[model samples]
Target: MFGAHTWRCGQRYDETMTLTLAPDVQHHAANAAGRDFVIGDLHGCVDALRYLLHKVGFDAAHDRLFSVGDLVDRGDQCEEALALLDKPWFYAVLGNHEDSLCAVAEGRLARHRWYAIGGGWAQGLSDHALATYAKRLRELPLVRVVGEGETRFNVLHAEFFGDDADLDAGRFDAEVRERMMWGRELAFNAARLPHYALSPTYCGHTPVRELRQIGSQTFIDTGAFIPEGRLTMVEALTSRQWSISVQAARAMGAAEMTLP
Candidate 1:
């Protein structure tokens, strides 16, 4: 991929700002000499988030957590979702929902999708706290990099290829939009990873039927929002990646919560 884009605050953040990768942000996946951890979309599934992190034996006090975006939407745990910062974490760029959320907080937009994403749960909170949280969500990072090895791993909400697949990061694929909003097709498609970008991408925009690998790319979005209540995770130790469900890994987590 060419590189990330720069996004100026669109009445989303309370503080005037621009959302872009740090100028120095570049291929780090190739740099991760050893193991690292990455996660898929959250979609307001806070319990799944906590369980997945816990099952992976994530050491927030030390290691890192990278995420594909859309952390808030179509789920019941909005408040707890943003609590990701409670540990070491990175947010790959997501879709317009996040940008829209920021806009609403800046008072530049309305909370139309908020209800769609369970923002109504906060209707009982004081108006000031609601606004405060909105501002916090506005400040989340769009992407992250870890380690420093030959297989630079890039984390993002969705794939970076364009319709032509020849386009750079500034350009995008048509499926990217479909993947961002409705990701049911993410499963069978996991095998086609590196074919999409220069770096091995970890994504969550599309919820796949299973945790499958294609080339070096691995998909982690397990549709925690669904009644099945399963979430996918990637374990990066010594540069090698592994995936396991909380129910499968935690003995008593969510047995029926198997990956599809």
Candidate 2:
């Protein structure tokens, strides 16, 4: 059960909860020459991502795309989606699905556990391939801070249950990282206090029908792998959005294949 703990409004921490320390954060300077975009969970929908990027006129040469993670699983093009990590302009924090991949690859978790949660794509993969994927995913930071000053914002796969100082200093432990990858209390509980004071934070683990914001924390997963869901992307500085429906993207792809 991920994030089984209950969280109440204004509550910062539960001292009784225990988790190890795993600190990793990545910082990027603002894209002064071009725009910066933060996208929702990929969930292996590389084609939809491509369509959305094309619609947005994303410039790979100058623009940057930051992901909320979950770059694998569910959809058919998991490998293609994961390869985006190699792109110089693409950056992502580690999502819970990626965390599970690491756990399974390192033998910390059972294969069945992973399979139960949309990991069927890796069933045929060799151990070496799995290890390679895990190694790359493990390098992703738990949180990514983009830009500076008022334009600055934070990107994490899930919830962050701390203040700006705690986030800035990277004081969260493994439990915190777990929550960052799997927690849903903030997204589920509308009354819960916002976690950060300085920079707005974007997260994706908990899927919603549309992009939502509670205080400074924004949720944008949008259920890209589901039948009726869509992959969403938002401009980091302006909150402008672009979305591509999964069904529509697939239909378009199929239609294109039949043509010249």
Candidate 3:
């Protein structure tokens, strides 16, 4: 782990330099019988997600949903969002928020720090509950390669500082892993050189006003927790996209829908 330093966005956090149990990378075979969808940071908006899934006619029997992570935090449906992990059709990578939660669960990060950064929903939870959530989140890979050949793409929470070879081999050191979950260079500076991931990499830690792509990297976090923000979903193979504002999703009776 990198030296304990102030995190991005000028937020000061006390991060313990400890190794994580999660695998750095994981691979999934292409969906032969159904379509694959990649969604932006959930931020605990499970109802909104359900609404979008219903709007898209998602078939749980055949289709799969991949998340860029931050599945919990800043919204009222955190438990519901985390519950998605139990569904076989849902997959996700680890985001920085999850990382902090893990640290807190392990007593490496202070609880107040986590609360200050949108994890307030966890304030009253029992220690066992927090540990359980952390354990589940720790099982998530930092990066996921989905599909194969020309249709293949990568899903991660944030920037990858290394080249395609490093990513392919999962040769990430602590610094690389930290950058993968928290880096924002690519999101803020589109023209920066060395955008060299071989596969189309989809990331979501840094929310953009709209879907933005630089080289092979796509930023899909549209700030669903913000008043004017919306949740974005993209089909991994076809690059087709759909989005709905939080208000709009709620107005559509999202709360009444169940995950399919």
Candidate 2: where are CA atoms >4 Å away? 2-23, 192-195, 254-260
lDDT tens per residue, model 2, 143-188: 8898777878999888887766677787665578668878888888
lDDT of 1 by residue, 6-61 (tens): 12222242234654322212234332333366767667666565655555665544
After best superposition, candidate 1 residue 164: deviation in angstroms?
Answer: 16
Report the lDDT of model 1 for residue 254. Answer: 34
* Order of quality (lDDT): 3, 2, 1
- Provide TM-scores for the models: 0.64, 0.88, 0.91
Candidate 3 lands at a TM-score of 0.91
* Rank by TM-score (best first): 3, 2, 1
lDDT value, candidate 2, whole model: 0.79
Q: TM-score for model 1?
A: 0.64
Give the distance in Å from residue 7's predicted Cα in candidate 1 to where it truly belongs: 9.5
Report the C-alpha displacement of residue 172, candidate 3, in angstroms.
0.7
Deviation in Å, model 1, residue 141 alpha carbon: 3.3
- Which pairs of residues collide in candidate 2? 20-174
Off by over 4 Å in 1: 1-34, 89-96, 125-127, 147-149, 162-197, 212-217, 237-260
